[model samples]
Target: MPQIAILQMCSGIDPDANLAVIEDAAKQCAEQGALALFTPEMSLLLDRDRARARAWIESDGPSEMIDRISEIAAKQHLEIAIGSMPVATAGGKWANRSHYFRPDLAPPITYDKIHMFDVALATGEAWRESAAYEPGRAVVTVEDTPVGRLGLSICYDMRFPALYEALGNRRCDCIAVPAAFTVPTGRAHWHTLLRARAIEASAFVIAPAQVGHHADGRETFGHSLVVDPWGEVLLDMGGDASGLAFCEIDLNRIAEVRAQVPALANRRPIPKS
Candidate 1:
């Protein structure tokens, strides 16, 4: 059983403050014997004001925040999965990117969030992620980690079953769905969708999340979850606060669930309409 840690955060507008939280969590994860530490989306900064946040968002070369995280990972000798951050692209659009940092000299593996969250809510809250972020085109997976082959996806991507289907097809052992979800949406769909994805993929779903009111006047639903292949909820850090939580990944459970359901093996490609 490999134990992993999740940092459920109420990240603010300050990048340095966020980095301090992560650095402390990394130290704690190392001390607690965790193989990896998973954090919520926008772990470094969660400001909704694009103009105010523009200064910290990285474009060319590695930003100080990224360098600090890399150093932290290396120093702690622990794998750290930074849920997502805003990174400027060459195309003049920013990317909501997830980065996986290893303890070794190996380079960090990154996955740009593919699904853009552009929606108008019943609560009158609206988001236009596509208006600023460049959507990713590729499906990314990293091999030989604490959880075997790990698939990467961000907040909105969890809503699209096809993305999980693709990850399922690749036989991932665990999938990361880091999110900074709004209260209304997270309440209605968070657990159900995460469990469904875990069941469908026959894999563990690790989701670290943002919780409580943010500095930018936004609130997030934060039941940071770890669901098993059998769709069992292993851990749920309630929405009330920000903190660190741990869960053990039973690697054998993957084979057991797949052996029972075998959904991935039985999947047939659908004909185009």
Candidate 2:
């Protein structure tokens, strides 16, 4: 069993200010005895302006946020999972990337977000993420620290259950979904979807979220949560400012839940019409 912490952030346009907040949250989580700490999407910057956001993105290795967080993780001897950042990738498009860093590694194990939010919301808020970012091709599951086999995903990916199913098939014990969910959608579907995913996959779900208003006037639903395999809410930081939420996850509980429910084994294919 390992203890994990989720950092709920209300990020503004300033990268420096956001980093300072994240640093403080990480330290607090570490002090609370959390072995691994996770952050929300666009953990460093939440700029809606395309040109300005593009300007802040870096090409090769780590960004200032990554380096700083890595240093902090090293100092605290904690494993850090950054939800997602905008990074320069091939084809002149940026990637919405999630990175996992251990105390020993200078670089991180990265996973680009596979699902892009390219729809017109009911509120008439249209987002073509593919216009600004490229999509990741593969599902990523990695092993490091107190939790054994952890799967990584970004915001919009939460709508796709098959992705999580794939991870579960690959034996992922825990899943992280760092999000900046719109207020309307989050209010309706956020908690239910997270709980369903946790129950279906028999894995602990770590969801660090962006709360409050962003510089772009986008209101994010901020109920950052950590749910267990049995659909229990371990920690819930209810739409607060910047905060840390912790949960002790027993890896063996995954097996226990799956054994009781046996839902994973019951999933069978039906013939297409």
Best by TM-score: 1
lDDT, candidate 2, equals 0.86
Which pairs, if any, clash in model 2? none
lDDT of 2 by residue, 1-273 (tens): 577888899888778888888778778876888889899998877878888776678533337678887888898888988898888876889999999988875798899999999989888988799998999999999875578889999989989999999987877888999999988888899999999889888898899999997886788899998888999988888875767777788889888898898887888977999
Winner by lDDT: 1
136-241, model 1: which lDDT tens digit per residue?
A: 9999999999999999999999989999999999999999999999999998999999999999999999999999999999999999999999999999999999
TM-score of 2: 0.94
Residue-level lDDT for 241 in candidate 2: 77
Q: How many residue pairs clash per model? A: 0, 0
lDDT for predicted candidate 1 compared with the true structure? 0.94
The list of candidate 1 runs beyond 4 A from truth reads 58-62
Per-candidate TM-scores read 0.98, 0.94
Model 1 lowest lDDT segment of ten = 55-64
Give the CA lDDT, 0 to 100, for residue 223 in model 1: 98
Q: What is the C-alpha RMSD of each candidate to the true structure, in Å?
A: 1.2, 1.7
